[model samples]
Target chain A: MVKAAQRMYYGKALAKLAERKEIVVLDADLGGSTRTSDFAKVAPERFIQIGIAEQNMIGVASGLAAAGKTVFASTFAVFATGRCWEQIRQAVAYPKLNVKIVATHCGISVGGDGASHQALEDIAIMRALPNMIVISPADANEAYAATMAIADLKGPCYMRMGRADFPLITSEGVKFEIGKAAVLRNGNDVTLIGTGQMVMSCIEAAGILEQNGISAEVINVSTIKPLDSETILASVSKTKCVVTAEEHSIIGGLGSAVAECLSENRPTPQIRVGVKDSFGESGDPGELMKKYGLTTDDVIKAAENVIGKKGKK
Target chain B: MGGAKGLDVKDLRRRADKIRMHVIEMTSEAGSGHPGGSLSSADLFAVLYFHVLRHDPKDPEWEGRDKFVLSKGHVAPVLYAALAESGYFPVDELLTLRKIGSRLQGHPVKGKPPGVEMSTGSLGQGLSMSCGLALAAKLDKKDTRVYCLLGDGELQSGQNWEAMMLASHYDLNNLTIFIDRNHLQIMGSTEKTMSIDPLAYKLRAFGLRVISIDGHDIKKIIKACEKARSSSSPTAIILNTVKGKGVSFMENNADFHGRSCKPDEKEKALKELTERMSSW
Candidate 1:
């Protein structure tokens, strides 16, 4: 499996956007870790090192956006979303400013730094805000494309990326849109929905399910806020049962979004594969994924469980 | 810079008195608001709008206009009054404050009424925004200065300190922060609420040129803002003001910090301001 860190691709995308003078990047002393140093290397003048103050970083981004500059505020997911959630709500979302809060090192994959460093609830909180566009890119390629896409977009957006280098699932030139989901592989026996690094696990699970004569469809749900209900409904209408996967918690992230969409339109049987409303512990990234039930085998097990309930009363 | 846009100190005082009267009337009409802070900062707002700020109320989005952010946004009355008086909108619309479907929300919302620059109600956030606007102006090579007004009590939020460090780090010479040192918060005096005193020393330690002055003095306000504009780095102007200035019953009173005057109290406050206006 060819793996690439989404944060790396995000930095590359920012460096590529150096020619756009209106673009400004801000980081809160985590530039090297979050990879915004890539942008600073090229467009040193436009990149703002806002020290370790996430709340003030968001405020500065809001002011820059108000002054007609496209601002991308980058930091760890915990600080970017958790420490300054209200600042984002008041300064960015309320005004509907053109500030993209791209957070890196999301989910339990941020190992060794422990629970305090991991951000398992960012998706839920970011999704709750009005006028906020929440996205979780499936891979590094999609992260790069989404970075370019959001710069072209003019409003408040939150894009969450992972810490470890996950499998490259999407193609290099994947056309990323703000509110649309991309269907990766096609089948009929069951539907597999996933986001972030977990989407790769979903695709791998579909392959395993195919060997057992149970066909599975893979859908990468990157844009979590506007749940691309049309695409999701169309797949579930044929598949009848569903399994959702993500590196975040099962509460208000991708799992909850899919559940709400299905309950409203399709009423299909679904199993959500994510952290079970618990905090993460310090461990290897792969070990954390397995312990938290976010691995490919977990997706396969969820698929089997939901598929069993497909034909039942 | 010397006396304020050809308007003498007497004229500016009259303008401030009218703004204070509008604050009293608007808050009484809304039946709620932070009139104490609004009244305290009315003089600063008057000086900024009438004297120092380079703005066109007729063309609120004028490219060359300077930006002012009401960091302590609960004081919407003074900003609304100043904008209305400066012709951003009709003065009659000032009465619609805090009412449903009015652009004049309880707090200053950006683009709600063209003159309001940033949407600020949450404290300790506006200074960082002012830094952004100032940095952008420098990046864009515009001479536009950014000013922010904050409540002294709001300094406890910690985010303000973060912003102060950024301002000094970036050498945001185009930015000026006015700390409304009315010495009062909702609970009690700021000294008792949480000591942020030795305040000027703290600001200087944070790498700002701290200027302390009587906030109600129109000439001093104008001169301090002017000095801040030309500063080699960020400046903090400490405006020593009464909590509820001008109104004898409300001055230095914490109860009026977030309350509206009663009907008779409103009448008395209005009468006092009117008399002060007539004397000018």
Candidate 2:
């Protein structure tokens, strides 16, 4: 399978979006790694090099948005969400400014950078802010589509992407809509929900579950904040049990969102596959994913666990 | 309120006094708010609202109007007063400061009133946002100017230095920042808390055209703004001001920095401001 990093496609999208006169891109000294360097190359004048100040980068983005420019601020996920969360809350989300905070190098898979660089809590914190739309694309194609979609939308958004290349699950030129989840596969025994890179794991988990005479529904929950409760409830209602997978903490990520939704609508037996209240260490991406229980086998086991809980109930 | 004519120093002075009176009234009426910094920056706000800023109270969202960001947003009573007295809203609404459901939040909110440019209270952020506004104006080829007011105590936040570096790097000629050097923070004096002294030279070293002035001098504030606009880079005006300028009892008092006046103190403050108004 040909794999692609979501950040590369985000850069491609920025390069294409450079022609829009109102689009202003800002990067905090990591343009090359975050792929905003591509936008800088095309629209040198529109691209602002913020030089390692993530807080100032967000404030500048807010100001630009206030003046009627659609601003895109890019940085590593740790710096993008954690380093300057208050700036986004006050300047961007509070005023409902049109700033798209696109962060790369999210999750434990940002290998070798260790815990400080990995942003397992980006989804949690960004989701907590009012008027902030949180999105985590499943693959490169969806990342590109999400980048374009957020630019057209007129409010503050936080969209995260992973660092390493992953299998291309969605086809090229995939369409993305805010607050909408896509159903990748359908079944009745159990529902497997995932977001960001973990969506790939869920798809693979579904494949293995099918071979074992177990039916598993696979869902790609791209927008984590405005969770697509309708699609989620529909799948859970039919399957009666659900498993959520994400390359983030089990606390306040996609699993929490799904749990919150299901508990209110239809309480179902569920298991979460993610990092368990622990920080990551420097290692290879594959090994780190395995160590953190973010692999396809982990998702498969979670699905089975939830299905077992369902039978017991 | 003359924009094209000679500077109305007397009218602006009276406006500053009236703004100070409103600050006292609003905070006292609400029983809590920032008054010391607000009193210090009244003259600058008066001059900006009455003369310097090209803003219409009727159309705050007009594309051509110059933008203002109060980075030291705890002093929002002054901004609300300036906006109200300038006819952005009814003057009576100024009395509702910090009350539940009042549009006049203890800190400024962007969308609540038409004139408030950005929601700000967290320090060191307004300058960066001002840089963004200035950059956006330049990119659009609009001659819009951006103004930001910061607190001296706020310089302790590392983000302000980052914004200063950025504003200088981009050569944001259309941006002007005012530092309300009232010398006090919530705890105590800024110098004792964290020395941002040798501040003018430091700002100049950061690539800004630095101007130091008595913040209470309406004429000097206006002139400094004009001089700032003539420069080819971002200008920073350090306004040397007493913590509480107009009211005698509150002058240089750190307690007034975050406190409203009691009944006796409010009466005295109003009388002092009114006496000054009559003298002007």
Candidate 3:
């Protein structure tokens, strides 16, 4: 099967949801890029094109939410989270408005747009805001299900998606619950947790680890903020070591979230494989991932390193 | 629709003066609040809450009621005064302006007060939210109008301009934006700090129905509001007003923008407005 873009899945999900619910989709002049144009096509009256104004989009979404409309604000991750940080903080998060900020083209995968467009810190920024539910789907299937899940939950939510088209790891009938981690392939040597676009690589990394006599349990943590700590702790307590992978800055992405949970809860030795604390350059997505030490081999190496440190201390 | 209820200009003038008096007393009690900007927009708020706004004083959350947003949230004293006078809360509660336990927060918080529409302490955000409310009303096929009062100093934030453009672009005719052209910022004049000269032209260029009026004149404010309601585009009512409008010592004074009036200052200020009430 061909890979699907999570952003396209996001747009299709909104368009489908509009058929039943009174959904309002807002875009900051990136409807085509973010794939929200799909929603605009289906329901033009419900779609608001705000013309490159990210802050206004967020504030407007809050107002719509206050008026009892399920509002989905779409833009690139950088502008959706960073440019309109205060608006999301004061208007939406502080008020706990039922507004969904679903941003696409996250991380270095934005490719040629370079560091300016890459949103390496979006997860961290949104996660820090109170009353904000941050979710990063692993693939297009999870992205669709997650989009539907956020609509059902009333409150401020931030759903992050990548620009690249990735093959689906989760099949149909798989339950996608927020704050619940999905353990795809179970093993006992070490636990590998990944989020957003990195979970696909984690599965492949587990494949490589299996060849090396390392049995790895692959867990997909879609919801990063209200993290599935119980599921993660259960797996880590069994494996005694963990590997966290994400296509985001290593400082405050999935790795940081898992580290924060384990360092305080279980104290498991872990290896975090992600973008270093630096800006991304303009390059092909795959090339940039290899250059930034975010690949299948990187995750495999990280799993081995953590497995090696399982009983040393 | 809003009913005049046989209330003449005399009544509105008295109400405006009373609002100003409350602003002065509230700020004086708070010990650190914006009196100048509050006083400047008191007349606008008086006319809005008392006469023009289609709201039920008893039902502050009436879904059909017109929405008002104080985008220049620093001048929350006047909003509290108007809300108090309109029976949204106790008139005596105006003295608890900045008290920790009081619902009357330093800035206008939506749920904090009955009539307050939304929380807007940071400048340049209220208009966008107003536009959103107006847009939602349009989507619902309701004629609920939205009024947002902005301080000239708050226009320095770029987000206001972005909202201004979208309000015009989307043809948010249900939204009426009033810029309190008080000229004075907390530090100095708006021109000296960040020159937003050619203000009318800037708003007109954004395709709004621009109406410039004396912010202190109850009659002109009414007329401008009428013109605003009739326009097909979003209306920008530019109010030419003094920072400290009613008080003799505070008018056009930048120092009075954020400072509380001393006891002596409050006494003189109250006496000035109280004298205007006897004729009623």
Candidate 4:
């Protein structure tokens, strides 16, 4: 397992992206947290700090793409997806412009800033738009790799990350693809599909379930929009029971995407583990994750419930 | 320089008049379009397509092509006429202005229409997109320029100011914006609806090179485009124009802001515009 650093993982990812010549980073005044400050310091021309204007920032990124410049517009997930949604839809997605939107402080993990800063519904908002590729990297290594991969891609993409430090699950050598799912464990009793920070929680839950003698397979689905349906369907068809986890809301996020896939392709008993229909409040990241039922224990409980339902059937 | 100096001003003025006539006729056929703004912007559109903009209609996506965005997208009739006449599409397709499934949507849709840089209809957003295009050009060290035409009424939207702030901050000398100050929106006169009178001062304060001109004067519009290209900072031209300039009774009338001309009204409007063309 890759080791978790003290600073936010997104910051490290941005720093690594700055090294590439093709990558151009843009920030709408939230440079301090989104970790674009490091890129600005190193390569000033490559970094654009469009202070406090999310709409203009998105437009600038789109323009850069038109001139054959690969641009990454970074901001809080709330502002990037919510405030500037129309700009994203018109300038980037509809035109099929190649602009990478990196949204940090995603989900409730953006602790103490309250519900406004925490973007629980960003996934739903972005995924609904046509021609948009939605991705949530599990850790710093994955974020770095995803950032690099998306820079080379030729269309609009949304990259979601967290404000706080997250556990680094995979090492540098692990191959990362845009629309493919990553399988972490092998089991047949039930399948657990998770994304973003929740992938780590699923890894922990898989270990816990093994102790209880319930074999569980865990899949880390990074790209939420163009979901790897074949992998997900194959796992659920064999297991016949599933537990989906994400830091996003149960509505239209990773869990919803998984359910949509399963209901259509392969019908399976499923339990979705995420924030119930509610808002997040001020607290530590760990406390908020636990309170919102986004912990490893929550996943274990959700998995057990799905398995129990299967036994009853 | 020799090509521009030797160009026939009379022929260009005739072309602008033809575009205005088409703008009225097509809007009348569609039964819905902003003729007031479209007629007001006729000269500027004519100058850009005929002289100022460096583009090949055959190769719309050419890497070094200069970009133009109609921020005042309600005036799409003028743009469509220019694009169609410039050989981007068949000139006969002008009658299909707002027809269902036509490439020419009510607002500009990029990729559907050659020479269209971005899909723009929502007000105050085009300037932002233009800034992006200009900034990209600057980054790539490409000499290509970006011109955006904004409605005076659209200045009421806050996003335009956001774009203004960034354009000045970046010193995007490659970007130029034209404000079609026709003084009429859908409701009434711009002052009564939403005042943007001190438009030049606002643009100047935002650090752009501001030029106020007679919008319908093709020569003045051409000179302003040339001046904007020569300016060190990003430029903003306020084209003081009367809404529906050539058509009698519709001139300076707010009712024509988006109302289609009746069958009889279309004949009268066309006759008036053709007569106005004879004077040039």
lDDT by residue (tens digit), candidate 4, B137-256: 777788988999999999999889999999999899999999989888888988999898788888889999999998877788888888888899999999998888888788989999
* Fnat, 2 decimals, each candidate: 0.81, 0.89, 0.56, 0.73
Model 4 superposed RMSD (Cα) = 2.2
Estimate the TM-score of every prediction: 0.98, 0.98, 0.96, 0.95
Q: Model 4 TM-score?
A: 0.95
Instruction: Write model 3 residue lDDT over A1-313, tens digit each, in one string.
Output: 5688999888888888878546899998899988889988888999998988899998898788877789999999999999999999888998788899999989888899899999999998899999999999999988999988998998999999999998887775456788888898999999999998789888999998888888999999999989999999999878999999988988888899899999999899999988889999899999999999988999988887888797785
Tens digits of per-residue lDDT, candidate 1, A113-175, equal: 889999999999999999999999999999999999999999999999998998897789989
Off-target runs (Cα >4 Å) in candidate 1 are A311-313, B1-4
Query: DockQ for each of the predicted structures, in order?
Result: 0.87, 0.91, 0.69, 0.75
lDDT of 2 by residue, B1-280 (tens): 3355567789899999999999999999999999999999999999999999988888888877999999999999999999999888999999988988999999999967669999999888999899999999999999999999999999999999999999999999999999999999989988899999999999999999999998999889999999998999999999999999999988999999999999899999999999999898
Best by DockQ: 2
Better of 1 and 4 by lDDT: 1
Clashing pairs in 4: A63-B132
Tell me the tens digit of each residue's lDDT in model 2 across A124-242: 99999999999999999999999999989999999999999989999998899999999999999999999998999999899999999999999999999899999999998899999
lDDT of 1: 0.93
Each model's lDDT: 0.93, 0.93, 0.89, 0.86
Model 3 chain B lowest lDDT segment of ten: B1-10
The DockQ-based CAPRI class assigned to model 4 is: medium
Clashes of each: 0, 0, 0, 1
Query: Which 10 consecutive residues of model 2 chain A have the lowest summed lDDT?
Result: A304-313
Superior by TM-score: candidate 2 or candidate 4: 2
Superposed by TM-score, candidate 3 places the C-alpha of residue A68 at a distance from the truth, in angstroms, of 2.1
